[model samples]
Target chain A: MEATVALIAEHFNGALSPTFFELITFANKLKIVTQAKPTIVMLGEEIEEVANKATHFNGFDVIAIEVPGLASYNPETYKAVLKSFLEELKPSFVCLVQTSTGADLAPALSVKLGAACISSVQEISSESGRITFLRSVLGGKAQAVFSAMTDITVVSIQPGCFERADTGACSGNVNVSRRAYRSLRIQDLGVRPGPGCDLLLSEAKVIISAGRGIRQKQNLALLFELAAMFSRSAVGCTRPLSDSGWLNSGSQVGLSGAIVSPDLYVACGISGAQQHIAGMQGSGFVVAINTDHYAPIFNHSDVCVVCDVIEFAPELIKAIAKYRQVT
Target chain B: MRILLCIKEVPETDAPIMLDQASRWIRDNNLHCYRMNRFDECAVEEAVLIKEKFPDSILDVVTVGPKRAEKILLRALGMGVDNATHILSEHTGYLSPFITASWIAKFASDKDYDLILTGVISEDNMQGQTGPMIAELLSMPCATSVIFERISYEERLIYVEREIESGARHCMKILLPALLTVQSGINKPRYPSLSKTLRAKKLRIPVICSDALLKVETRERPELIRHPSKSRQSLILEGTLSEKALELAAILDKKSLIK
Candidate 1:
């Protein structure tokens, strides 16, 4: 009997997370390499609609398990339930989006099931004998190819790595069932709203973001000064600035912060880590400034200035202001 | 109360990467240019904060790496961890997260720590697995990406705000004897005091050989390392500094991005 490749469906408060379809598409790619088709495991309290929603788009067997005690994602409840469920099913590959939830679940699940766990997987290469998965390392400065010798492997795929499967029609079977379990050590206190994303940043037509390349916290003032030029503009920073407490958490932009799609984005001194690139990639026009010509940010920008961001910012600020006055 | 904090050393986020036709970042010339994993610094800071509140708390920091790994341990001690352990790993390149977690778990299981904490993920691997894997190996409840936490001393519950998608934080209350992976930016990590650093330097920290311990070999291996194709390539403006700046202004104007 051959094993299975499975994707754990994601839902937030019973509404299906958009990443579910992307997971389906990634799993489909893995299907060709592993010679095993993918199945969808939908678990939560009231996931019928989300599961039904999934089957509508993706044609994979949907195993919808409603655990009576789980209203929201509690890692303990998830590990307790999914471990046995997976043990019985024995999937060769368990795939999930590399969201906070999946990041929490996959490693523990892998340990419980004695499976190998690979995370933030961005690409899959099949020509390399044993289905190797590629993921970023050194903050996306480099990439690594990983493969599992174990029978079971759990992978968390980074968002935006694969094209999402489109929504259309339900072609697969949806098995709706209930599982009985009570969480012992963990209690889900539901969710409180995250920091208010300043409307200035979220609604900005022109957004300027900075990173470590700014040299120091004082350089952030330069980024702000540059932001003052645009009619509707604001300033943001990458995780380093946020982590250093140089800027408030609200102005941070990345997978963990604001995901914005502004009309124009100016990235200064930012190395363009994968997360930061993902956050700002949706911007219509992007210009990046950095000292490191080989900086990964250059790959994602529309216009790249290979210079120290600090030196370029003041000049660009002056140039833009002067140009605006002339025009 | 006893707390166990797991730490890791990683390449500085800004060092020029040496990538070959390549998979992993070859840490050849850049071996000396590394520091404590940024996220783990937050974990150590959080543990220190917890200890400050509960003065009776005993905090221990541990790292699984080579001889150079001790520097991070000493730094943790300087940051106010009560003790440090160096689980010396022989393999220098790409030790599996599972193998790392198992060894740490083996060392931690009998210590009966009331709480355990680790960085949400290592900056290099970004797998974010060791903390949760240790939690599983020890059968302890666990939480990941924890940004804020409080101990309800009398209730003996830890209330936490775990970071989720798009800045949303999922709150949870976990019973004691649990594990948490601390997300960065939760707090400003305190710099090591000179006195503490001197004291930490004088202490004889324990170094346990990883091979001496029961082995949990890696089931996964790195087959190859190569840079992925870029999604987009920027139009680099070739010129002097001021020239590039003027060009940027023109480009933004051309794109109608400037008002």
Candidate 2:
């Protein structure tokens, strides 16, 4: 195992995603387990700045594949360029953050390069001398540990799994490679900014979020009432609630939704899927209410109450009201 | 138009599931409590919607699973799918997404499907690999996490809106012979109509032994299934429902969260 290359993810709109820093951490971690050298890879048009910044920050050599894809990420183009470039490098590991782009790219790239592909990995463990990637399966109900069967492995690290390690010891060298690509099968149209983008999510002091456990649309009033109990609070929801039209997309909280770090997060009926937890785990304090005792929400909660949200929210609302009155 | 949809049969999310630690695979498959993967239900609905708009199009739904997997195909058929193909396998254990995608790709390659669609990720595996793998195997374009799409018959292209981080979306124009993995909430999946359900029941579906498909080399395998590592205190508040609520309120109040 020579090099563990961490590919920096760029947002579809060409902005650099923050997940790449975590990818560097994961790459270094995997480097330790495999005794491989660590490298950083970035793809975009004129990415010298990002590459150099990462180089100086992580103290790892950067491979900057400069292509003319700034408007949007073209999967076909990425696949074409990376297949050729990575084939030459033949690195032991190719690490990417499990964002929408990474999730879409990892499997296809693995098939192209004849590498073992693991998706949405949240943790890494070494037993004896062998290493395995651990990821949640069955919708966060359990965990699965997987081992690569091939020489080259492509692993997508789940977002929010690894804390970005500070690395400014020394600047490494950058290797620039310019490539040209023409897509015959696909064309970029553009991006539609999500509707109902809630600025309140970022500014709110408290967020009361709903999930599938809320059961029905009408039950959401309880969460709204709970949110009203606190000042500067707003109602948020998991993807399912937004998908069901019970709430707008802007009010949704998760990896693909809004990412908020309020002082207090009240999770109602949320099962605590990694996608949902990744967004709100930065909250100062957390409380979760659910009927399922094994609900994953408990894992991230400061206080976990094993009761139906429908039953619990009203009581919490009443208790908070009474406490406020007494004060 | 010829469209192909891939689906999976998974344990119902609400079912009481117990893990078999020795085998490292969850059990209760012996029972009949199974349903289509929720993400795939959205795909099934999307396929039906496309079929409705293009009434002359042929909609084929395929699943690679064990005997019990016929459930998804039947449901797809009941939802107005024209054809159902079951690549049968008895491997009750976990099947790598690569292997599953390879089998379906082999079956669909010669059919020359104009479009292929599936759920962004299966609830059971959450790998989100099969759809893109199929497209790559067939040398076609691919997209994932598609929140909305519309087909342009004249241009022979499918325009897609793929959701990215924070609900932002990237829209792309995919050539006809492309694959799209639909995200949840792309559409509300509808239940089967009584007439369609009865008609689908009477129709015998075509089944192909998964072993018959071209051998696919799997890149990874699960070594163990363990309980997820806890990231917080995970302290369970034990008491009656009201007592638990009041306790939570007290905890928040102690932190001065309630004012």
lDDT of 1: 0.85
Task: Give the CAPRI rating of model 1.
Answer: medium
Off by over 4 Å in 2: A1-15, A68-71
Screening candidate 2 with a backbone cut-off below 3 angstroms (N, C-alpha, C), the clashing residue pairs are none
Question: What is candidate 2's lDDT per residue for B4-74, written digit by digit as tens?
Answer: 99999988666546776666766636663788999999998998899889898999999988888887788
TM-score for each candidate, following the candidate numbering: 0.95, 0.96
Location of the lowest summed lDDT over 10 successive residues in candidate 1 chain A: A162-171
**Tens-digit lDDT string for candidate 2 (A1-327):** 345565655543334578877887887787777788777777888687766776657778888888875445888988898899888888888888888889889999988988889999988988898789999987788898989888888999999989988766688899988988887788877666777458888789999999989899999888888898889999999999898899888998888888899999989888887788888999999888888887878888888888788987878888888889989
True interface contacts reproduced by each model, as a fraction?
0.83, 0.85
Structure candidate 1, residue pairs in collision: B22-B225, B22-B226, B23-B225, B23-B226
